[model samples]
Target: MARPGPRPARDHGRRSQPRPAPRPRGRRRRAPHVRERAVPALAHEGEVPSLARRRLSRLSRGVPARLRGPRLLRRALSRDDRRPCARPEAQARLRGRGEGSRLRGAEADEVGLVLGSTQDRHRGGLVSGIRLERTGALVTARFDKARGNAIDEPFTQELLQVAKELGADPGVRGVLLASAHPKLFSPGLDLVTLIEYDRAAMERFMRLFAQAVWALYALPKPVVAAINGHAVAGGCILALTADYRILRRGGVQVGLNEVKVGVPLPWSVALLLRASVPPTALTSVALLGRNFADDEAIAVGLADQLADADGFEDFGRARLEEFADKDTDSIAITKGYLRDAVLREMRARESEEMDAWLERWFSDGTRERIRQIVAGMGKGR
Candidate 1:
């Protein structure tokens, strides 16, 4: 009876449950590479990357392949490219490659932007790198100088001349100040250029700069600054002179950063700021001299509108036209009244202000800082 074979399994009185099979621990799956996750179609098919794909590759270059998941891949393909890369080194590397702030040629017109092609249409090279284009009642003054449209003698003179020309022309109902290059407006004074100037030369240019800014500030027409790029120091002052400012939405900064560089705002410049920014933000904006992105700039009243960089120029033109279509007579008169006090203060204290600015400009500490800044920027004369 008991053949002593295997015991008949001890089933005491309960039914036994079957054990599940163990999961095979194959080599831990490596996260998919960015190319695979971002563009599976192209990756599997083994085709060359297009501009968009190149941008994606660059966006994920330094990131670990494991971290380049589907979420990050989506961001790489979408509007977030307007933001900076996750890695600082990657950003600097991109800049060194002359790509200019993650601007890719995925779209049609952006091809031209990435190619660094000049706008040949309606371009009048009136002042070397500066261009003046007149279309109907709109006059566009574009600064396109070397070194981010540096504020040198020719630049100051061109601005002053353009302001005068627009003020006198009865048919000109609006003016739009712009930059030929989309990503760089102006970096204020040409420190390297100015560092070589003798005292007389420096004073003369500074005086001319004041006159230019005053002329721009006092212009009666609907003046709109279409800033598609970085605008700091003198550039910010130039923007403030406008009745309204439209700045490119992302990856650009605008500020009156004179204090950071050991310079004070000239009287005319200070007046422009006081009128443009709100009283609540005045002290912080003027005294701190901090750079602000598009949203922050609009919030502080430094920038009036935010525009996408893709068609920023056209958008600015349409916006300027909107303002220009208003009642020219009443708008002119009202603007004059609003600006009268600023003009009075400017005229009364121009001499004293110039003297103070010159004194500070030539001070030992300021000069040393200026030299250091120039050296750092590798813009030495």
Candidate 2:
């Protein structure tokens, strides 16, 4: 027949397999569901991130009461506490705690040395060559420096800073200035140091020196100088700045020896001498540049009183107490009125006077005299 009709393509002895069904439009096939294993809980209870734990521990130790416990924890954990370590109070507290702990590393060693030595020395603050101690309304600043508490750039600056601080504090009623050295209040200006300065440097030094002197002279609170030892040259100038000068009874000498040293007295220093010294003795005291014994110092108005070493502190304290009952405002006002003319003159002539001082200080004759004096000191030592 017609080839048996294209006869159903011949059966090749194999059964036909059915095709897979098509996915529905707009619908994806779902993946098989997997059973996930649970993670185990931490071994300790109330566990937190390491950083958070550290923060909480610090807060618990030194933070204010209101900022401790859960309140602090909540704040620390919040996003708002991004810079928790940057808080000033927190930083200060942390520093205090660190100071209490053992010191390690270079920075810790440095800070520890300063804090420990200063605390031991004054139980207060140490600024350069000066050690300051505060007791009630009174502050005592003791000068202790190499070479007899010499008045150098650093010493002058520190003394000025302390004077300014005391003057600004309304609560500070009095200041006591004393020397740590037993035989010397101050050997005056450190000529060894001064001899090394150039003309410009000398000018700067004189200006700074004058400023320090004026700061102490004009301080509102009563200032008493306990001159327990020899105070010569610049030291004498310093003693005169105080409202009351109590010299310890001894062979210790006190006087302005600038003339002997081949240097002229600065105008400010001259004015101070005028105000403190007896008019009759001013010529001898200032012109001669002689060092006076405690008895003579008192007699000539170079020192207000004389006290034995054992009674030096008592004398100074007594002097300070003399003004204790006086009205602070009235006392300050009276002092201002008494010193206004001199202070005004000082302000007007500061630069010119300082220039003259520098000229004298850096002169060839003065330099040679200073060298000889230093050499003599070395030889004596």
Candidate 3:
């Protein structure tokens, strides 16, 4: 009996109570506001402004008054996702608010289909100067043989037709006046046509060439020039027509060296250079008729961008896609507005004024100097 009593006295008072049952693993305890935010679409699918206000109110509940404006503005404009995706054509067109040549041989076939026309084909030649690539929004100027890429009279006609078509099209988004020639964007104009023609035809050629340059300059969509090789004279003019120029690195010389070949830059082309290139560079270039290297061209505002020779396609594609992201209507309107100024300036300059300017600055005197320089450098062309 004594042993049993001793055992029963064993520390019942010191024993701890059994721990309460643990809460269920999946049952999370959340703040009330957090729970409301968890089902975002459900609470505010149709009430965007109201929901935004509610969220802002919640965010600013405890912040002092002075800090609220900055905080709210930061929240309003800040996008959770800034990465660009392939947007719908309409959406792609709205990104910005304000803001090629010929080739030798037969032309390439690079026309795209227009919407709803009996002829789904894009306008031939000039209108179809743009070629849409499969991988990106790359639209290169073609000089392939099939579609008459040759720089001849017939080809020029076709090119003009294409240009007219593009001008008329409301949906055309951008231009990339590229060339198929491996070494030359264009060898100036097709001398064959110009040399063979009489005075009347020569005048027509001049008018048409000027108009073509104007067309490129006037395109509402952003135009980027990608020169894989040399851009000489008329080709140089085409490059200048673009809002942005990217020259492939190395083995290329860009300038209006028409003086060397006994011609002057066209009036429209001269106006374009005046508008596009920096004043100093334009003077040195048009007046001197000097060849500018890639870096020099960029420095002079002749080339807005430059990249490695091998990466032209990738770079050009990205740029076009970026242009596509901008609002098309805004771009078109702004371009037209700016282009009207350029057109007026061009119209104001008389042919005599242009010729005199060229003669004073880059006449046969300069041409002979260039010839000596070229000979000294061992460049036969």
- The most accurate candidate by lDDT is 1
* Residue pairs with clashing backbones, model 2: none
What's the best-to-worst order under lDDT? 1, 2, 3
Candidate 2: where is the Cα deviation over 4 Å?
1-127
Better of 1 and 3 by lDDT: 1
Each candidate structure's TM-score, on Cα atoms with residue i matched to residue i, is: 0.66, 0.67, 0.57
Local accuracy of candidate 1 as per-residue lDDT tens digits, 1-381:
857775343467765665689868655454545455445432212322233354456666666656776565544432222222222333444565554334332321222111111111233222334555555577777787788788887678767866886788797899888997767788889898898888899989988998998899889899999998999888888888999899899768999888877778988888778878889888778898888986899989989889997888889989998989999888799999999998889888888878788888898898999999999898544
The candidate with the higher TM-score, 2 or 3, is 2
**Residue lDDT tens for model 3, 129-228:** 2222212233444443222232555445545555565556565666666765677766566553344455556565666666666667777777777777
User: What is the Cα-based lDDT of residue 2 in candidate 1?
Assistant: 54
What C-alpha lDDT values do all the predictions have? 0.72, 0.70, 0.56
Return the candidate ranking by TM-score, descending. 2, 1, 3
Q: Which numbered prediction scores highest in TM-score against the true structure?
A: 2
Those runs of model 1 whose alpha carbons end farther than 4 Å from true positions after fitting are: 1-127, 379-381
Sliding window of 10 residues with minimal summed lDDT for model 2: 34-43
- lDDT, candidate 3, equals 0.56
